[model samples]
Target: MTIFAPTTDSHEQQAPPAARRRRRRVGVMSIVMLAFVALCGYLVGGFLRFTEEVNLLAKPAAFAAADGIVVLTGGAWRIDHAIDLLKEGRGRRLLISGVNPDTSVDALARLTDTDRKWFDCCVDIDYAAQNTVGNAEIAGRWAREQGFRDLILVTSDYHMPRSLIEFDRVGNIRSVTPYAVRRDDLWRGDEMPSAPGLRVLASEYVKLVAARFLSTVGIVAKQSVSTRVADLAE
Candidate 1:
């Protein structure tokens, strides 16, 4: 009877080849799936980000006429809309969070076409916040201190969803009214969207995704250095 025994060398050589082939296939498949998922995410997010709704108005009429207005800064339209509403008597008090410290309050008033007195008395320039999470925390504190139960939250339409998350994360507020600014047609001549405009939208979408991830992991609650200092001073 002839019996065949498998040698160690044969097993080792065959195993390595099969294992390498499997690894290559897995790596290729993983890359393809990851690309597909990323594409899908971007497409869906872009669609939602660009699609403006009739209800883009952040604040309801009743809320707009509330005790105070909280405008989270990012886009130019956000500040413009807030200033317009304030001029129109949307709210008695306005808190413009995420203001640049280098820019004087007087300069901001001039930019918004509001009086210096408004900035001194009614409006607060929050210089601490560097991002949306900071905006929410700082604004939330201001709202609580002012005893404002109802507030008009002003931000861009694309940002409202994420802004709401940050704003609401800090408790002790009655109502948050969203006032989304209407974006102009991003498309240029011939109705073709401008590359710069699309780039801006894409950048914002990326930020939103990052924000969502940070929020999920509770990173949003991590106080910044400025926030800690401010708290300690208080």
Candidate 2:
């Protein structure tokens, strides 16, 4: 008559901690996967937006003269374009920023196929700048030294945005007019991104994002080494 009552709680009570651990691990993995997917989506969206901005950049129909011109060194024909702008009286002076220390004015003249006379008269070399931030600093200092209030900024098509950001932060130069050098064959009206074009744009976008973040954090090159912090006497 001592029959044991069958208990429904036996299996529940015997469930090991291992089962609970498995559930916890699955939850963590799910969260991680979700976060990863979200990050990918964000990056992809940013890339698309970057490309669209580059494509939509308006080419300057005509460039008006400014106080000076700063040409950032990189890309094919950038310096040549700057030289042409200088000859056209777009600016009174030209600072070829981020130039190699070993590069001579004669070499640059030959490279751009411009007369050495122009380099000797109007061109100033900035061998200190090694990056875009440095470019802004060096150019700003030159502008200040020359008592320039407005400057025409010359760079490749994809680089204008970032360069302007740095220039704006410099707080020395009053105005910066962008004169972007765009190759007709590089990109066209809403055309599909080619391999080379996409690669270049993607690289620039990443750099732009990085520069923006650094600026947000108040991280920038030291003024002492690059630019003078003193207010330019108007």
Candidate 3:
């Protein structure tokens, strides 16, 4: 008789706090998964666009004269091509932005099959730059020293976009004409890109995106670059 009142149905019972927490956690996880998927789609789209743009640079541009030429050291072909541009009078001076610290001007000229007179008269080398940012900063400084407002930027095709970003951020050279070098390792024989080519593109794409983002966000601080202008006399 004391417990005469009917008990509430189990359906009427409120969920426990722990159950609510689990439900909330599941909802959050679902949202995170959706965001992750969306991000992946976006990145894949960007990668495709990057590849297309890089491929299009294969169409050669008309050579326009600039105050100076700057080549980012990668392969012998790149250096040789830049030197050829110099010979064509496309630029008054050629600044090789990244050179081996141990490699003297004599060695570089000899190795590139360049005439020693070219190095002595019109070519300058920078031994300080270790990466793209360094290359931009070093090249900017060299351009300023040479009173050059326009520059011809030489680098591999895939590297052109990123190089442009850095050069733009550096902001001293008023004009830049890109000379994209064709790489034998990429786009083999009108076929689909090889695994290694894809890998290289992916790496470069990520870096390019990062550079664009950082530069946009105003988070790109001037890097402390120790510049070593190679003595052409050496």
Ranking by TM-score: 3, 2, 1
RMSD of 2: 6.1
On the 0 to 100 scale, the lDDT of residue 69 in model 1 is 88
Error of 2 at 226 (Å): 9.3
For each candidate in turn, the TM-score is: 0.71, 0.80, 0.86
Residue 158 lDDT in candidate 3: 85
TM-score quality measure for candidate 3: 0.86
Measured by TM-score, the strongest candidate is 3
| Per-residue lDDT of model 1, residues 23-51, tens digit only | 77999999999999998988786656443
lDDT of 2: 0.79
Per-residue CA lDDT of model 3 for 1-234, tens digit only, reads 476654554423466778777877999999999999999999999999888888877567686799999999975488999999999999999988778778888888888888899988898888777788888888888888889999999999889999999899767889988998877687766535667779988999998999999888976545435445433322
Leading candidate by lDDT: 3
> After superposing candidate 1, which stretches have Cα over 4 Å from the reference?
1-64, 183-193, 221-234
Least well predicted 10-residue stretch by lDDT in candidate 3? 225-234
- Model 2 clash pairs are none
Model 1 global lDDT (CA atoms, 0 to 1): 0.71
On a 0 to 100 scale, what is the lDDT of residue 28 in model 1? 100
Query: How much lDDT does each candidate structure score?
Result: 0.71, 0.79, 0.83
Residue 57 of candidate 1: its Cα lDDT?
41
